[model samples]
Target chain A: MLIETDVLVIGAGPAGSSTAKHAALNGSDVIVIDKKSEIGAPKRCAEGVSKEGLKKLKIEPSNRWVIKELSGVRMIAPDGTSVWLNEEKVKLPEAGYILERKVFDKHMAMDAARAGAKIMVKTLAKGIRREDDHLVTTLETMGEEFEVKAKIVVGADGPESRMGRFLGLKTTLKPKNMESCAQFEMVNVKMEDPDSIEFYFGSVAPGGYAWIFPKGDDIANVGLGILTTETDKSAYDHLLEFVKNNPSTQNAQPVELNVGGDPVGGMLKELVTDNFMLVGDAASQVNPLTGGGIITAMEAGVYAGEVAAAAIKDGDYSAKKLSKYQERCEENIGVKFKRDLKVKDYLQSLSDEELNSIADAFHDIELDTINTAELIKQLIKVSPKALLKLGKLF
Target chain B: MIIMKVNEWCMYCGECAGVCSRSLIEVRENSLKFDKKKCKECTICIQVCPVQALAKEE
Candidate 1:
């Protein structure tokens, strides 16, 4: 069998679905395919994102998907020193909520469907190659095979992006720049605070951090991520130990467990080739410092969709014509991503002593009197080059 | 029971980590690792792996 469209998007994750929706809204015929039998199941995030990211994407907060709306964030250092910033006092990247990704992801895909993009679940792209002017993609669904011919192909697949490789673009990451994450969904977990998300940093999750995102009064998602270095154990071991030792969740009942790898490499140097563009994780659009890509993926998706639509209308699908997507993302979040990469590197270089010292530097600070700008200014006095790069991370 | 094992072909992209019902497997920066004791052998990880790097220990 064969299917044809102006734009064929692979993978129905946040990136792919948003691209398809936006492209369809721009008058381009779009079809999105996912190998998954369901659109949004097996959620894989700490389930928090910047509220500003949603507002910029014009996504309104809906009660349908929000698990908990958080106004502040807390980070615990090695010596048990803690620092926090509230939404009322923080900057672009810091203020947001603990989300329910399962519903959140489905809602975005549903929005795409409502926008006129055809969504094909359980359909997987097997192979793709350039055939004349159109890119030919082979897909498998159940026990059948079919071909899709499209003027533009979007690879929102993921970190193991096959389409990026097909385009000869570098999309793989080194271990140092990737995170292995694991989480447990707990009910009746006895969360200390219903409105504040907690993060613990130290040997408990070396090179990465552990997060407790509250779903309600007694339910929360307890998760930890670790750099896959020469750790004595895997992320699984760390998370298990973390749960056992943590006071707040020692008796928590495990409702579900999830694990995944995330690219901490920021945006790819090349996200486009002739007739093809990469969005979201396929393009390495995740933040190197935060291991967050929910918004970055959607942001890239919107750009890729809009750019693909314009290219189709102009009848030019060359790399030069598709550079607009790259430019748009770079202008929006690329600079911040690059700076954050430096901060990630700097954090990795810090010893536990340095981390503790930094935490102590913020000791006794009144929360109401603090703001991100003032914090950065204070940080600059401690280490100019280091904190200057980290200043924008908030 | 969930049984898990990493085959020799695993490219360590860590996609399988996304599917495990339990946090039994982990993606090392350069390799993949899993605690067989934790494997439910649900086979979700094996099914999602693009390189077929995981398998039922079984």
Candidate 2:
């Protein structure tokens, strides 16, 4: 089979779907392909997204895909001291939904399809090469080989982006920068507050944190991410230990398992080449501190789609034209990513004692009056050294 | 020569492939492919596996 498109998106995740939708809406012919038989099965996410993030994308919340509407966050220190931040009190935009990604992702693809983008499932790109005025991609689907000639190719292939490497972009993640994650959707779990998500920090996770994002009153996604360089044990080992030790999940039974690697930092310097561009995890657009990328990926997709469509209309597929995508990303998410990476590094450097002290300081504060600025002031007071390390972010 | 092994516990999640310094691994739908000739024996994959499915053997 031979298919020709103005834009070819390699993966149909949130990034690819958004890119296709916007590009197609802008009068570019777009085709999206994914290797998975089902769009969002075997989800690699913890399924948490902030309300502000969805609002930024202009996506209204639907009960069909929202498993739980969370109200706030709780941080647990290494010594088991818990500090709660009520969303109503703190006015935190981070409080939001635990999504059913299996449904949500399919809905995103559906939106793209409705926008005139073609979609192929269980299709994998074998290789790509430069053609006369476009790029040619060899794809395999259902034991059939097909060719796609695209004027612009967008790589939205997630953290392990083979498409990026094949295009001569270095997308390999280092051990220290990558978070090896393992998660289980567990049932029959007990929770102190199902309306609030929980994070456990310190040696238990070592370079990352354990999380419980409640799905319902008796179910939650229990997981943890750890740096491979910081521990000899695999991420699975740490997760098992965490579940066994944590009081809330001790008796919970895992109904599903999800594991993947996240490039927490190290955003690629270049996200485009002649006739090619990268978005989402392929471009390392995730938040370093929180490992959140869904909103950022959608944002990158929007930029890449608009830029690609404009380049198509202008009949210029050179790296110079696609460089506009990079510029937009840098101005938007890139600034925050840089600061987040630094904060992630500083937090990872803290000892368990230091973490406990920081938690203690927050616990001592009046929660009703504390904001992020005030919280940071309290943090600096507790550990004066934090000012020197985190001063640049301010 | 060092070769990487995938045990039965493997989930084909592609974590190993993403971190491979040489990009020597590929995760298909149900199987993992490794290019032993290009491997540098970093063992980073073994450490990153969520299920301890990967190992380095000499």
Candidate 3:
């Protein structure tokens, strides 16, 4: 079957859904397609989002999607000393939420549908073609193939997106920069303090860290992120090893397991091209420090929707017009992400001993008062020799 | 029998204990104590031990 629309959105995750929601609300005829039959199936996330990020998108905490409200965090050094911080005092007022991601993502898509966006699920986009001034696509739906024509195409297709690749943008990620992760959803576990999230940083996880995000009194999501370049251990291996060794969680019943990666690098130098735009994982908008992408992806979607609407109104689909989306993202969200990457890089450079010592030293400090940069600065203040090893990355 | 012990440097934060599957370890007297009999020898404890204290019995 052949269909035409004002805008075509690929991959109905946060970015695609939000883009469709905004465009449909503005009276643009939009269609979103995803390969999955269901909107939020086969969950592959840590399911944690900062409070400030959700509020920015105007998504309030709903019981259906929110499993718990997180107010503080605990950092465990390699030496075993711990530092705790109240998230609010740190200026992350909405600090974060341990969400039921499947529900949350599905609901976001529903919001778009309610606003008049037509979604095509279980549809795989085969390839793209440029005809005259329009973009054409051949999509496979439920064993059958179909063609779609649109004036504008938004690629929210995620990490393995082909749309942007076909348009000639560098989509390759270096092993040094990518984080491999694995997690398990556990139940019947007793935590020392269930309300606070926990982080374990050391060489064990390599460039990344391990986390325990409490979902409720007895349920939690435990995961780890490891730098791909540092080790050959798979994320599942890391997660399994941690589970076998930890005393607090050793007694818990294993319920489910999750594995994935976080692309902690910067945004693509060019997320837009002639008549095309990228968002979400496709655009590499994930937060470099935390490997969180829901907030950034949604924010990117909002900008893309607004830009695509304006472009349609003016009948202009050139890269020059879409460049506005890139500008808005950089000014609003990109700046913070860039800074976060710097911090992430710094953290990645530390030795297990150094991480433990830093944790031990900071045990007495108030967490809410220190930004990541300040913490690193303090580490430098206390140890001049350590700073020398960093070599001016600061 | 593998005897897993959390390092004295550990704060009993239970990050490793919480992710364990065999229910072999527990926090007692503000330190990691274990029951090696129930251990499935998964070694999640060794990998996530923030203090690098947990070690297999020789």
Candidate 4:
């Protein structure tokens, strides 16, 4: 079959769905393709987002998608020292929700469908090419071969993006710069506080951290992200060990397991080229410091869709025309992501003692007083030269 | 037992190392080293290689 569209979005995750929805709403014929038959099955994600951050994305809080409303976060050091921060009391730092990602992604895709975008599930983008002014995307939908032609193609195919690779774009994250992750959805969990997401740092995760995000009082997502180059053991092994020994989650029953990877190198130097744009984990737009990509993916999708609509209308699919999306992203979100990568690097270098000291710095401070300036003031006042270069994060 | 083989196309991306339950694959600055005892032959590392750098050799 032959299908033609103004914009073709490859991958129907939160990123692709938001792009398709926005492009269609902005007067472009859009089609979204996903390799999965079910839009959001085989769930993966720590599933934590801040209330304020969700509001900034303009997505209404829906009971259908949210598993739990996260009100606070607690970071635990190797020696068991802890620092807690509440989302509601913090002004600058962002925190949001624990979502059922399968449902959240499905709802987003459905909203795109409602906005007049055609969705092709179980369809994979096999190859891509440029013929004259239009781009042709070769596809295989559930064993059937097909093709799509479009003026603009958005690649949202996760960390190992093949669409950009098909174009010979060649951007990649180094093994050391990527986070290999493993997670499990568990029931009968014993969380110290159901409303607070728990983060444990040190060798348990080896250059990363372990997280327990409660879906309910008795169920939670227990996961961890380890630098791909840090250790020879798989992330799943680390997660299994964490579950077997951790004080709060030791006795939980594992109900499901998921493993994945994300690039933590910030945005790819070039996410847009002639007639093509990459969004979400595919573009490496995740927060390197937090290893979070859900919100950033949608943010990049919005930008990609907006640019695609305008570019389609103008009949100019040149790299120069589409570069506006990169500029918009850098100005609004890219700068922070770049900054976060540096913070992650610095945090990785700290020893257990340093980490404990940093956690202790926040011991007496209230969440309301945890803004950057205040934190910086507190750190400098106490340990001034101790953090040195890393202190700049505050 | 499952044994996986690496091809010349290995990107040295450390994916094989990242997925191995044991510390089997060692990613060095310029090459990769595989250990027999550490490898359970599960073949998951082979399946997840993005570049098809790995193959199953029973």
Task: Give the candidate number with the greatest DockQ.
Answer: 2
Candidate 1: regions farther than 4 A off: A92-95, A367-377, A380-394, B1-58
Clashing pairs for predicted structure model 2, backbone only = none
Off by over 4 Å in 3: A93-95, A368-377, A385-394, B1-58
Docking class of 3: incorrect
What is the overall TM-score of model 2 with all chains considered together?
0.97
- Candidate 2 chain A TM is 0.97
Assess the local accuracy of residue A296 in candidate 4 as a C-alpha lDDT between 0 and 100: 82
How would you encode candidate 1's per-residue C-alpha lDDT over A1-394 as one tens digit per residue? 7788999999888899889989999999999987667766677677778888888889998988877778777777778788876677655353376677888888898999999999888776767899888999998777699999999999988765666665677765555556777789997687556688888877888888888888877888899877766364667778989999888789998898777677787788888999999998778788888888988899899999999999999999999999998899899878889888887777776667777877788756775686667867776665566565565566
TM-scores of the candidates, chain A only: 0.94, 0.97, 0.94, 0.95
Candidate 1 clashing pairs? A259-B17, B1-B40, B2-B39, B2-B40, B2-B41, B3-B40, B3-B41
| Candidate 3, B1-58: lDDT as tens digits | 7676555655443434334444345442244567777888877656543334566765
DockQ of each: 0.10, 0.79, 0.02, 0.07
Model 2 Cα lDDT, one tens digit per residue, A173-226: 887878989999999889889999999999999899999999987999999999
- Worst 10-residue lDDT window for candidate 3 chain A reads A86-95
Q: CA lDDT of each candidate? A: 0.78, 0.88, 0.76, 0.78
Candidate 2 wrong stretches, greater than 4 Å: A91-94
Q: How high is the lDDT of residue A68 in model 1? A: 78
Better of 1 and 4 by DockQ: 1
How does residue A40 of candidate 2 score in lDDT? 81
Among all candidates shown, the one with the greatest TM-score? 2
Q: Which ten residues in a row have the lowest lDDT in candidate 1 chain A?
A: A89-98
